[model samples]
Target: MNKSLSRLESALLLVAPLLMLLGGVLLVRYDDQGWDGVLAAMAAHPARSDVGWLLVAAGAALTVPPTAALAALVRARRPGLGATALVLTALGWASVPAYAMGGIVMEAMAHAPDRAAQVAVLEQFNDGRGNAFFLAAALGAVGYIVLAVGLARDRVAPAAAAVLIGLGGAGTLLVMAGPIRALLLVAVVLLLAGQAWTVTAGRRTAPASAVAAV
Candidate 1:
């Protein structure tokens, strides 16, 4: 039953992040069109009264399930890693509130249409109390490192399966180190790939030696 649950969880981890990535792509592709206009018009429809919010919310929602699964797996197998996952999840989830504030600020700007106020709100929404977001980034980095350690220990997934997970975490960490936001894109890609591999591979085949060790 535990193994079965792990496989299901693995599938979610792979699939959910991929969906989020796709949603992000949609937003980016449409930004020049309705997205930018919507941001500008937020003050006009402060409560997300338009369709644009749909895309953003959908994309954000995709990130949640996989993140939760990752946390669950980490908690089961590695306590320290679980704590790291929690921190990362906390930051990732915080984006919603920050974004909601951004929406409202945009709405206010629409009402008054002040460039200075718009900029201030935008900046605040981007960084305010969002140290959690940054901490999440760092924690994701830590997660990859911890996963690598687990891989080495052959505790959870097979060692062969650890590459992308490790890479995803490392990419996340790289983004946290400085102006490597580009690395974040790469990290997302790695996460999707890694999760996909795990899902398809199913549970690890515990070797005879591993069984004896356990």
Candidate 2:
């Protein structure tokens, strides 16, 4: 069972990055319009908007497996920090599907005849008072940093992996620039590479005790 589980995790870790990358590409491709122009843009490019949202939703859902796998690996080495990082990152990822739902709303707005109504819907989507959004952002930022540090200190993963995770955490800030938001994809790619390395290397070097614990 243990070996089987490890193999499953490794597979997930490998696939997660690819999904994230594809999703990011779709998002960037469809995001020609800024948030302010989302309705008009969706109306103009309905197919792109639909496909992008679907990809985003699928990619976001795929992230869960790798997140859990990484957390489990880190937990084997540093329990407390690993658990905290896992929770935070999980919460952050959970919010991604909500964005997909918002995309649905955008699609609806695209068809609405009243421009004023479309703007109101967009505003609500933008300015919603849900704490989940803030929680995901704040926790994810801190979680990735802490997870990177823990992974480095425990030597469970390569130093490069830690660096990539750290940079990914920082890349969140680039979202404000819209076009530069591709930084998120870059970050995900780095993370995917790092985690893949960790799984392969960790399995080879990990002591029997460590493997059992993991």
Candidate 3:
């Protein structure tokens, strides 16, 4: 069989969505209150907070294998949507490091000597450099939507899964804070479903990626 995954990648793909889902749960658990809450959580439960960040980021980055497989699957049938999704998602992953940096900055904010210092740092970061991350995030969201639609249109995944993925993609694009950010958990669930669909249903469409069905 023409396999896209070499066991290790397949395993990682299987675990990636779950890890990210778990991370989202943890993130919402602690940083649901926005920047204020994130910094607070950093001080209140540093380990859990950091772990959540790592899980979410790592899971997202690790999704490469499955994403590649999905891209390959859809690309063969719906080249336009598939290519757009692949590019946008790759761009979206760019936010990973930016997100990690944001977490680090939040930790610094938590430890900052005073409010003034925190504000100063926040201002500096937000000046321009930080604003650029929004583009990456937005692009990533667009990519998810495109991929979801592509897969569904190509019959690689169900329409229900596509809807979930589209909704999740929209959620990721929103600027949420407080308990509202908990919506991210929904996105994670959709992500898992979408990824799972790729592993199972999508595999049927392409013979070469049987091993990478996830």
Candidate 4:
């Protein structure tokens, strides 16, 4: 791919995550962990719920290319670990469509005429496929952690940055409170800095290693 294109995509990866996180925050505010809460929120703030879901879906989709490029760099140095990371990342991100569908369902639920209709929509989503969402989300967290570890092990990235990446990814996944997720900002700064160091190192020695990864 073109170098400029790669850079653009990397920039997208950096920014797109903010959209997903912001969307998540929006959803959290409305869905008070119950059907009644969801119906109420939808009745009161349906538009906000719609925007939140859209942002999350768009952000997740936009990051795919950049994440793939990052995985390729990791693979170039260590094939086995790279393959594992790629699989995990791909599988984890596979939840994107499911998430998108979730937004539609929420909308449907919001427009539902009554509590019983809303319950039906919610229950249908609670099917076997629903179980996969949790697993995929968890895998995505682990995937980023593994990718950072592999990059560091292959000497393509700073070990400290990799460590920070792992911590940030894990922390974001484990923390439930809305405020605590602000750790994402700290993580992103370290991520950008670490990626910058990796690119500089690659340019100075092995240019191929960087591959314009952000």
Candidate 5:
């Protein structure tokens, strides 16, 4: 059962990143209209909006499993550091659903007859002033940083991977600044790739007793 569970987690970790990457690609590909434009388009084509939002939500949801798996793997190797990494990663990832779900809200707002109201809602959402927004951003940044450190210290993942994750966390500030928005995607890819490596490495190195205990 433990081995089966481990395999399941590995599969989930592998698939989740691919889904997220696909979602990111879709967002960029379809984003030619920008947020306001996309919302307007979505308003006009409800079906397309539904599909897009669904994809986004699915992608966001998939991120959680791999993140949890990463924390678990780290915990196995180093308890204290692993605990810290898990807490931070959990906090950071907790905000992903909200961020992804914003697409659904935006789609609904698009249907509003009053264009001005629609714009107002979009602006407010974009402003990022809400408590949830702050919580997600703060927790995500700090969590990734801590996770990266733990990964490096424990030698569970490559040093480069840890650096990339840390850089990605720091890069969020730059994203808010409006330049190099793509950095987020790059950071995600790095972190996911790193985690994947760790999972594979763990499977190979785990003792039979340890594997059975899990």
Candidate 6:
């Protein structure tokens, strides 16, 4: 039963990357824009824009399960792993506000067809609260880092998965400003690849003793 459960957890973890991949693809195909750009496009079409919001919501929602899988692995291994996972999970959850704000920002951008509203949105984006976006991105990068560390330490997640997560996180965090933002853009691709690998790998079983306890 523990083994079966482990496999189930692995399966759930894989979903994270796959959904990211799909979302990335949609962003590229639909708007030929980055994720934020896509959201902006969607926001531009407020009434009809709900479609894009749905996709954004879907992508954001998919981030949770894999994070949970990471937490599970941590709990199974280290004594204080649960606490660490919870802290990281809070960071993961922090992205919610960013995602929400991005949606609003996008919606505002959509209204930009009218110069006045566009100016208002631009001002809002320039304010200190605009930092929420950076926070979201930072949280995402950190979450992946924590997830990778947890997986590697627990021996449940793949080494390649860990590497990819780390790489993605690093890529995103370091070059988040200006044209370098393109590097961060590429992180999305890496994230998708890591997730796909995670999902496709063979599932493993936990120890018999652990299974009985669960």
TM for every model, in the order presented, reads: 0.59, 0.79, 0.78, 0.73, 0.71, 0.64
Each model's lDDT comes to: 0.51, 0.62, 0.64, 0.60, 0.57, 0.52
Error of 6 at 23 (Å): 3.7
lDDT by residue (137-181, candidate 4, tens digit) is 678778878888876775555687567655554443323112343
The collision pairs in model 3 are: 2-208, 32-178, 199-213
Expressed as tens digits, the lDDT of each residue in 1-214 for candidate 2 is 1232367766766676666566666552324245446666667777666676666667656666766666666777677888988887777666666666666667776777888766765556555754456557667667778778876776656678777765664353223113454676777677676766666664333543766888
Among residues 3 or more apart in sequence or in different chains, the pairs in candidate 1 whose N, CA or C atoms overlap within 3 Å are 42-107, 43-106, 43-107
Please provide, for model 3 over 1-214, each residue's C-alpha lDDT reduced to its tens digit, 9 standing for 90 to 100.
1143356655665687687667666652323224565566677766666677688778878876567666667888667878888888877766765675566557656876676566566657666787677677787778888887876876666778667666665455433222454576666666666555545543446543553675
lDDT winner between 4 and 6, please give it. 4
lDDT of 1 at 139: 59
Ranking by lDDT: 3, 2, 4, 5, 6, 1
Which is better, 2 or 5, measured by TM-score? 2
Candidate 1: stretches off by over 4 Å = 1-7, 28-112, 124-128, 169-184, 205-214
Better of 3 and 4 by TM-score: 3
lDDT per residue as tens, model 6, 123-209: 565456756655655665565567677667665547887678667644533333223324545875676566556556544637436
Where does the lowest 10-residue lDDT sum fall in candidate 6?
A: 24-33
The predicted structure with the larger lDDT, 3 or 5, is 3
lDDT of 5 by residue, 1-214 (tens): 1232366766765676566555554442223225567666667766554554455456546656655655565677667766776676566655555555665666677777787766665566556564565566576677677777766765656677667656654343223212243665675576566656656554233533576799
lDDT, residue 50, candidate 6: 43
As a TM-score, model 1 comes out at 0.59
Superior by TM-score: candidate 5 or candidate 6: 5
